[model samples]
Target: MRTVRIENLPNRSQMHELYHGRGSLGANRMKKILVVRIGALGDAIHALPMVNELHRREPESEIYWAAGPSVVSFLKGHSALSGFITVNKGVKGLFNAAKLVRKKFDCAIDTQGLIKSAFIAASSSNMVIGRAWNSVREKPASFFYTEKVEPQKEHIIEQNLELLEPLFPNETKFEIKYDIPIHEHPEWKFLSETPILFNIGGGWWTKLWERENFVQLANRIDKVLGLPVGIVWGPGEEDNAKYIAAHSSAQLAPPTLFRDLAGIFSKARLLVSGETGPLHLAVAVGCRTIALLGPTAGTRNGPYGKEQITIEPQLPCRPCHSRTCADFRCMPMITPDRVFNEIANKLER
Candidate 1:
C-alpha cells in the first residue's frame, strides 16, 4: 500500500494520467463505470452534478452508483443513473462488495475516498479513480485506487466535479446540471403558495442555531414581507420542527420525501437552514438559500448555486468540524437581527 498526500489540485501530468486517455493497454476499452459516494446526505447530494457530467460524457456507458441505503431513495427515480448498490459501513459491507465483484464492472470511481469505499472499489474492479486515500483521515485505503485525482480546491462539490475533468477536456463547454424529477403531491399544496421554507435540523447538533433565534427570525420575516414560512424537518427532527412552529408565526409543512422535498424547495422564495441535506438540495434545484454555518466552513461544504447566502460567525477556532462542541458560544453568537437583516436584503433584491 502507498500513501500520497494531495494538498492542491493535480498538475498537468497528473491530470493526464487521471483523465486524459485511459490508462495503459486494456483500460481505455472499458464500457461500464461504477461511481461510489456513500455517506452523509449532503455529500451524497453534492455528488449528483458529477454523476450527471459522467452520464453526459459517456452516454452509452452504464453508470451505476454504490452508495449507502439512505441515499438509494434519492436516486430511485433518477434518469441519468443506471442503478444503486447498497454498501453497509462495516464488516458486512466487505461481503457486499465481494457480491458486486461477481457482476464485473469494468471501472469504478470512489468519490467518497474512505477505507470502506476504497475496499468496495478494489473488490469490484481494476480501473479505479479517486482522491488518494492517504490524503483522507484513513490512510490505508489508497491501495484501492489505480489513479488518484487531486482536485485544486477544498470544496467537496468542486472536488467531485474535478474528478470528471479527465473525461471531458474542454472546460467552458462542460455544463454541470442535476435533473431532479418533481413528483406531484397534494400534500405539498401549501408550498405552491408559500414563498419561504426553513429547514431546522441536520446531522450535527453544533450546526443547529438556537431554536428561539429561528422563531424570532420567522416572526420578523412574517411581519416585514408577509411571506408564509413553511418549516421542514427530517425523520427524527419533528419535535424541533414543532417547537419552532409553536413559537413562530410560520406554518408547519407535512413530512416530505427526499424527492418531493426538491420540488418544495424549488418553489420556495428562499430557504434558511443550517448545514444539512435540504440546504444542498435547495441549491441543486435553484432555490435561493440562506445557510448558517458553525463548525463547518462554507468554503468547503457551503450551498452550491447562484442564489445562495451563508452566515458564519468569525471565530479563530471556528470550522473545527468537530462532531461535538465544547463551547456552544459559537452558534449562539449569530443573532436573529443579523440573519433577518440579511434575509430582508436578499428578498428586497
Candidate 2:
C-alpha cells in the first residue's frame, strides 16, 4: 500500500457531505465504540481527526474516550465523544478506568500503541484493533490487539485514520478534522491585533531549544518584524516566559488554559516553537507555525499545514526520539538568525 499525505486527503466537511449524500450506514444499528488514546496533549490532539471521522461515518454510535487527566480540560467538550473516562496514573484512577472498561463494546481502538493503552482496550472489549508490532511504539502492545494493522501513512494523523479500516473497510476516503473548544477571554483585549507568538516549552528535555535562542529570536523579531511578540507559557513555565519577556521586546501573555489558548492561537499571526503540545495546539487552531524539531521526526509529528515549516538538524541520529541525550547538538544548530529568516519569509507570504 502507498502512503498518503494528509494534505492530499479531503477534509471532514467534504467527507461528511459525501457520506451523508450516499446514505451510508443507517441509524438502526448504533455500535458502542471505545477509543483508547490516553497520552500527552499532542498525542491526544492528533487522535481528534480519527475520532471525528468515526463519528461522521457512524453518527449514532456511542463513542467513548479514555484519556489522561492532563488532557481532560482540553478534550472534555468534544462533540464526537459520547463520554470521557479520565485515567490518571494513580492506582485509584487506573482501577476506576479498568472497572469502567468492563462494560463490553463493539470494539476498542487503541491509537496510543502503548502497553497501558492496549491493556485498557483489552479490558474494554474482545475485539481490540491496534497497530502491528513493528509499527507500534511499544512492540509488546501488539499482543493485546485482536486485529493488528500496518498503517501506510507518513503523518501520525493519517496513521490514526488507518485504524478505522476494520470498521469502515469499504470506505476508501475520510476527512481530517480537529474539533477543539475555542473560548474568548476578556483579557485578550490587551494583546496586539496580530502578534507573533512563541511557545517556549517541550514535553521532553531533548526537544527544547536553548532559552537564550528564544530571547535572541524575540529581540530580532522586535527589531525587524515590528510585530508585538508574546510569550505563551503553560503551568510551571512562568519563569521561562518572564525571562524571555524581560530580556527581549516580547511580552508575557496572561496564564491561559487549553480552551483559552485556542482563542489566542486563532487570532495570532504566527507561532514559533519546538516540537511541543502548544505547537500542535497552535496548528490545530489554524495558526501559522514553524516547528524547530530535534529528537522527533517532523514527517510524523510536525505541523499539519502544507504552508507550515519544520526546521530540523541534519544529523545521523536526528530523530532519536529520546527524552534526553548525552550531547544535545541538534537544537543549537537551529540558530535565531535561521528561524527569524523563516519567520520573516512566512509572514511576508
The best candidate in terms of TM-score: 2
- Each prediction's RMSD over C-alphas, in Å, is 6.3, 7.8
For residue 101, what is the lDDT in candidate 1?
A: 54
Residue 7 accuracy (lDDT) in model 1:
26
Best by lDDT: 2
- What stretches of model 2 exceed 4 Å from their correct place? 1-27
lDDT of 2 by residue, 295-330 (tens): 999999998879789999899987899998998999
Error of 1 at 95 (Å): 1.8
| Clash pairs detected, candidate 2 | none
Candidate 1 off by > 4 Å: 1-28, 166-173
